[model samples]
Target: MFCYKFPCGEFQTLTKMTETGITFDPPVYEQRYCAAIQILEDSRWSNQIKKVVEFGCAEMRFFQLMRRIEKIENIVLVDIDEPLLRKNSTSVDPLVSDYIRRREGPLSVQILQGSVADSSEELRDTDAVIALELIEHVYDDVLSKIPSNIFGFMQPKLVVFSTPNSDYNVIFTRFNPLLPNGFRHDDHKFEWTREEFKSWCLGIVEKYPNYMFSLMGVGNPPKDLESVGHVSQIALFVRKDFLEMQLENPLVTTPNLDDESTPYKLIHSVDYPFYVDTRTEKEKLWTEVQIELQRFKKMANLSENELDSYQETYKVPIGLILDRLHHVGATKEALLELLQENNLKIDDECVIIEDCDEESEGSDLYELSERLSQDVILTDQEHEEECWDLNQES
Candidate 1:
């Protein structure tokens, strides 16, 4: 495994990997963020979500959970902590880089070092922006600029932010009598009450007519326990224009990244698994097609020259062929291309013998198919072979 070098000569590694990716923080703190991710994932406009920009993406634990949204292709992590961003970028240790390289699918993960409250060049293609458990950490001056920077300037379709509810800190005060200024973390400059948060959200939409707001809560206390509000209060701001545009036309899914310029610095970027496979797509599809053909040959007891015999050539329905291909994960679109390349017959439902020679007795469906295929076929039995204790093939 080769390691990527950084100018600082410091090594960074992504040692902690998990489905929920809760992070070093307490579960309740992380769970609030996780709930925000669930809300975005379950929202009606989720399928339209393609590119997302996450503000204050500390350690990128939340980004891992956000992958549940199937259509999300691009995730950009923006944080002012450049060293922390570099540490989580998998830019140093080979072991960590190998793990990141092995992550499956095509989601592009980018790390940027920049303050969220700046007049930075906007990533125009962003569908949604997430800023969970972030505002409380920002200084009051910087915090004031966020609504205008994110809602007015960046102008993504949706924005979801969560801040610790000061009202809910009574539950924490029971355990620790010295809960500092009713804030969950010492780093947090300030925490807000439910009403304060609601007022802030309303004021944002009033200033920027492009968006409308919704309020939700997460991490409710037990029913028997007294109500002190949720562990965190969430505000979801959706673009008013986006809702109006949907009424007149079908969703425009394709990204329009016309302004390629960006103020954010690229700290790291990684392409997940299957970006380049050892086998070409055609080769992989053809391998499955040949295996399915062999299975058909074996099951039917097809003779070498049986397809060339008299008026009726031995054959199976194209539908059945596709079904077998489906079992082995060959898509219909790929099958069409593979068949076209190999000169396979596709006449409605029937799959006829390819390059059939009427004069030659040796030309059968199995024989012709075997000759036509560019790959070697293994029996279905071999595919189902039990794994050995060691990695070596038996």
Candidate 2:
């Protein structure tokens, strides 16, 4: 009945329809955070986002996704709860901060003990501010201060806010009986319906005439159940004055922020693995290969143990490893060169240990993996720059 062209330049026709209808479970609350990241990534000013502030950073689980935005140089996390912030920021138990800090990039993270309702001189003029699942937990008096403190005073180029929708409480009650009277969390003072949420966002737009706003839902119900709206709602606001200023002067690359000020007490920080543009491209990549190859070596060792279920010939899949390396801007030639240098081999199906001996009963594979785990030495060690020139350690 319908024909469609596919990406491979092939056309397909749909001839029959299934009688069974599709079903959807209730929306997951994590969709709220995903919507925030998508909004930033797809924004018209994506290139303009060099700094972002995550106000009301609960447990900081969403911080991982924020690190992937290529342009973000600094991320500021603020939460009022001192005890909770200390635990999350500490490198000890429930290691949220430590986990997010494993990456290596030009990016740096700063954690502060502060309330969103209160304004500070250091927290002024950011590219974007994300307050997710935060406002509902504060009292009305504190909640009122957000608009003046955040939008009026700080005045970021973009702002995103999300909260639980009370209309979707019925769906939640089935899974969680102790929702504290249909609210998402026990600490929340109040959750708003879709109408109330939209009205509040509109109020911000009207109060601050220099900004524009849009509203959308996350976690829609099944096809015909349109009456039940999303379990969570998102309100995104953009600064109109700033964008107009940008249009008039396109070459102004600097954001309206105080990058040199140090009012915020620094907490956990990380540098993610990103390539640099330098003259020694090959040497730098070779050093990085020597560093990150340990991950695949351990993976191969673990695969040997599960060989009974997988193919005994060799267990690790090559495509998955390639895909991961591709993320760090590694080429296929780089991967092949690294593996060959480390005495590793791959056949048509799986990555094979060079000395994988059936007679040794997998002991050879384990030992080779252990040996490769040692520090990888670069071929051109005396070539002016040492291995540490990449500024990375295994």
Candidate 3:
């Protein structure tokens, strides 16, 4: 097999190789990488990406993912391998070369032959930049150049990138651990834990005054058990100007309780798996659900411990922003009515509901009926009974 130069300047041969002597062909990592790309496509960031550039995209997976959100107007694929670019001409994945070719008229695909270190000027004027599974391959001497070139030159609105969690590789690769810095992998110049990744990202963001960074851990346990706090880290770097403009009161408010069942309707209208894909992307939604539920509980003035049961029993507001979207400017009656309709009872200090206890089956309804009676609304017993029936049950 042809031994490729490692990022550490060492040459290593793969244990297994095809007749063509191609080493380091990992289909598993590739598929998981593609799954990460899929996760990005389903997130709120998808709406912001209209033009895309994939540095070391390797097989055009990120490009394909971007297209699912919107038609890509321009694409630039950069790699050091010219033969790969030539073969990309007929790559089964459309974005490689065929996508630009088949764009129905005068369109051109820009393929640059160079490494990211040498191609900073080329990474220009794009809506989003993706550097997936590319940083691991950069030689240590050239590593600093990677981010500086991209941020210093391109200044794209957003950047989505992923790298190996150092712990993941160490645990899986079983390299020396006693050393302060840990052992090096066969071909990796550096492997980073989530924290190291964040520090580097923060340093890069500091260099550019207009950028802000958010870190998202991308993978699940088996891949990274060390980062149990959050899963894999998926870093998102967005320009501060764009973020401020977008968040200028995104017009989100809490839901009104008594808007003719519309609040209930809207909440229920949310599709099952209120996220994208459950199979591979479940962890992303799980993190989102946890984060949002906490925000909702806080907005409702419920303690963290209270939400332990709340999240299990019912759909809690994912975040106050989302809650604001649901109830902003809503009348107090409408808000209270929605809470009651959902079997959620709110008091001055606590927002609560009966547990899934069989004994409390009709108790909330009975209490709600009494409150309505006191208000001189739903005075008819039969109508109250119907209202209970209409509102209760999922």
Candidate 4:
């Protein structure tokens, strides 16, 4: 996992700002946790997030979660406030940092002190844009600025926005009920009802003709539906063409259930790592073991092949291989045995079996593996002829 540059010193300086000496508000964490849960509820939705842009992220906790997503390429944090942005430059809460830090990668955090309209060139290509609890803060005079601020400028594939319902704002008054008529935000220009939000989203869709809008946390209710109110509506606006293609004729579905003609009928891969190795009978068993072991290596980012070798020598469970790797500490022995188990010919003296280029001899295994993974060049025919039995294919 890549690390976020969270300024510990700056957080120490801002510690006094916490009312109860807790730097992060529990409600903020709750909201973030809930959003993550919501994202996970829809597997397709969770998979769709690649590059993200978050607007009005006070401390960028939401963006931090975006960074955690497995395939995420970039995360851009945008906020109008300078201090809040500065805080994202460091630790927002010391206690929560460690738990969440390992999950975060190096985010492409860009702090812009203006609305989403003024986003930089890098932000315009974001795959998704999130504006949670921010639309209400726009002044009534600048209400039109909302669509003009985001539309072609951000050009996000999906837009997610949430705000409080004006009609159901009474409950939060005592806790935060200072606003007139029980509205959530004191400076909020307008609080929207369910219909009002849909209408607003429709207007946005009209402007961005390719967009499709739907209300989350509404029709498809969850188990804890009683606590949820109409006041808090989460809106998902996806590109209309994409939504139509996905919903109407999803290419990725259960395999051979009915339509056998579809190209991507299987929800998961059958012979994903390699296709050619699955066809032949002689190498089938060996290939299966190799594929599984390769998956383990890739997932764990193991530089040495010791775990692979140990797994082969002992014929142990995947867990045992992992344990031995951890116990023995990753060395060439572990990986070589794992590879040998998968039918690779191994000699005691030939532990360093990799046909290293003369240039990378002194380099570490990790660095060599990285280079080898990218170098797809076919080896010299003479080397292949001289190495071992031509029919071995080990």
Best by TM-score: 1
Query: What TM-score does candidate 3 reach?
Result: 0.46
Give the candidates in order of TM-score, highest first. Answer: 1, 2, 4, 3
Q: Candidate 1: where are CA atoms >4 Å away?
A: 1-26, 67-70, 91-106, 244-263, 273-394
User: Could you tell me which residue pairs clash in candidate 2?
Assistant: 103-271, 103-272, 104-271, 104-272, 104-273, 105-271, 105-272
TM-score for each predicted model, relative to the true structure:
0.59, 0.57, 0.46, 0.51
lDDT of 1 at 294: 52
Ten contiguous residues minimizing lDDT sum, candidate 1: 385-394
lDDT of each: 0.64, 0.62, 0.48, 0.48
Please give the clash total of every predicted structure, in order. 0, 7, 29, 12
Error of 3 at 336 (Å): 38
Query: Between prediction 1 and prediction 4, which has the larger lDDT?
Result: 1
Model 1 lDDT per residue over 96-198, tens place: 3334334334577778888788645445567899998899998988888887677655677888888888886675565556345546677888889998998
